[model samples]
Target chain A: MDSIYIHIILLALIIISSIFAVSYARVIRGAIILGIVSMLVSISLFLLSCPLAGIFELSVCSGLITVIFISVISLTLPPDEKQRKVNSVSMMKKMVLLVLLVLVCGFSLYMLDSKNITFVPLMQNVQESIDTRDNIWNLRHVDLIGQALILLTGLFAVVVLFKKDKNKDKK
Target chain B: MSVENILLFKLYIIATPVLFLVGIYAIMTTRNIIATIIGIEIMTKGVTLLLASCGYFNGRPEMAQSFIIIMIVVEVVILTISAGLIFNIVKKHDSLDTRNIRNLKG
Candidate 1:
C-alpha cells in the first residue's frame, strides 16, 4: 500500500515536470526539466522491479539526452525576446486547455473499474536462471544487430549533415 | 493478479496516455524546432514507462530490460541525428523558430 502511494507520487511528479518542461520559454530550461522527468521515470522503473532499465533510463535519457539537447540549444540562436514572450503567451493559452483535458481523462481512468478488464495472468514458469544480459546476447541478438546498424547509419547521417560544403562556401 | 499489481498497472495505463498527450501538445503548439524534439523525447519517456510496467506485470523483467536497453541505444542515435539536423537548420535560418522556415525551397 505504501509503495503504491509512492508510485502514484512518482508518476505525479513525472507529469508535473513534463508539463513544466514543455511550458518553459527557455529551451535549455525545458531540456533540464525533461531530465527531471527522465529521473522520475527511472525511479518508477526501479520501484517496478526493473533495475537494469532504470539504470539505462537514468544514464541515457536523463544524462546523455539532456547533454545532447543542451549542446543543440547552444548551437542554435536564441529567439528574440519579444517573439519568445508572444510565443509563451499563446502556448500558455493552449496549455490550459490541454491541462483541463488531461485532468478529465485522468479522472475518468481513475473511476474506471479494473475488475471489468481482464489482464493476462503473470507467467508462472519464467526462467529465473536466464538473466537480462544473457537474454539480450542470446535470444535478442537480432535486435542488437539492428541497433548497431541504426547507430552506424545515424553516425554517417550526422557526419554528412554537419560537414561544410566547400562549393557552397565559395559561391 | 495482486491488488498492488493491478493498482500499479492502472496507474501506468493512465499515466502513459497523459504523457503522450502532453508530448503531442508540445509538438503541435511549439514554434521552436528543438521544442518539437523535446516533445518527442517526452513521448519516448512515456513509452519507456509503459514498456517497463508491462514487463513487470507480464513476469518478464529480463526481456523488458533488454528491450529497454535496445530502445535507449536507438533513441540516442535518433537524438544525435536530429541534433545535427537542428544545428544545420539554425545555421541556415539563424533562428530556432519554425515560422522562419515555413516554405520549403528547392
Candidate 2:
C-alpha cells in the first residue's frame, strides 16, 4: 500500500531493455532484449493490478512474438553477419549512454518538480467496478470478435505468403 | 492515491515519451529492415504503457486490460505479417537494405 519496489524495479528494467532493443545492431540480440522488455513490462502491468493483460503480454509478446522475430532474423540475416563479438568500444558506448539516460531522467524529474505539475486521474466517478471477464464478454464482445477476425486474417496472410510453391515444376 | 501508485504513474508517463523517441530514432537511423520492425515494437510498448497508466489512473482496470489485450494481439499479428513480408522481400532482392529495394517500376 505504501510503496512497491518491485514495480519500480520492473519499470527500470523495462526501460533499459527497451533502449537496448532499439539500439542494438544485431537483430537476434535486439529481439532477445525486446523479449526482456516485454517480460518486464508484463510484470509491471501485473504490479499495477492488470493481471490479465500482463498474462497476455507475457505469454504472447514475450513468448510468441520473440520466437517469430528470432525465426525471421535467422532466416533473413546473412550467415557471415552472425558472429560479431561485442568489443570494449561498444561496451564503453553503452555505459556512456546509460549514464546519459540517468542524467536526463534526473533532470526531467527535477524540472517536473520545479514546475509543480500534478497528474489528475480521469473517470473518477464510475459508480461500479465491473469484472474484467464480464466486461470482455458482455460489453466488448464485438471488439473481441474483431480481434479474432484480425488474428485470423493475419495468420492466413502469413501462411499464404510463406507457403512453398508447388508449381515449381513449370519452370 | 498511494505513493507507490503515484510514483508508478509518473515513471510510466516519463517513460512513454522517452521510449517513443528511442523507437523513432531507431527507425530513422537503422538500415536493416528487421531492426526497423524492432523499433516499431518498441514504439508499441511505449504506447501500451501509456494506455495502461491512463487506465490505472482512471480506476478502470477492466477497460484498460481489454484494450491492452487487443493491442497485444494486433501488435503480434502485425509484427508476424511484416516479418513474413520482409522475408519475402529479402528473398527477392537478395538484400535486407531498404535502399536496395527502391526500383519497383516493374
For model 1, residues A40-148, the per-residue Cα lDDT tens digits are 9999888877898899999999999999899888867778888786555374678687877778776767666534543645656457647998888887799889998
Q: Positional deviation of A58 in candidate 2, in angstroms?
A: 1.0
Give residue A129's lDDT in candidate 2 (0 to 100). 88
DockQ of 2: 0.51
Worst 10 residues of 1 chain A by lDDT: A114-123
TM-score versus the correct structure, for each prediction: 0.88, 0.81
Candidate 2 local lDDT, B1-106, one digit each (tens): 6665667677777777777767776776666788888889988888888888788776787888888988998998899889888988888877677666667776
Q: Give Cα distance to truth, residue A12, candidate 1, Å.
A: 0.8
Candidate 2 regions with alpha-carbon error over 4 angstroms = A2-4, A79-127, A166-168, B2-4, B103-106
Of all native A–B interface contacts, model 2 reproduces a fraction of: 0.62
Tell me the lDDT of candidate 1.
0.84
Please report, in order, the local distance difference test score of every candidate based on alpha carbons: 0.84, 0.78
The TM-score that candidate 1 achieves is 0.88
RMSD in order of candidates:
2.9, 4.5
Candidate 1 clashing pairs? none
State the displacement of the C-alpha of residue B35, model 1, in Å, after optimal TM-score superposition. Answer: 1.1
Q: Count clashing residue pairs per candidate.
A: 0, 0
- Compose the digit string of candidate 1's lDDT tens values, residues B1-106: 7877776787788888889888988887888888889999899888988888888887777877888888888889989998988888878877777777788889
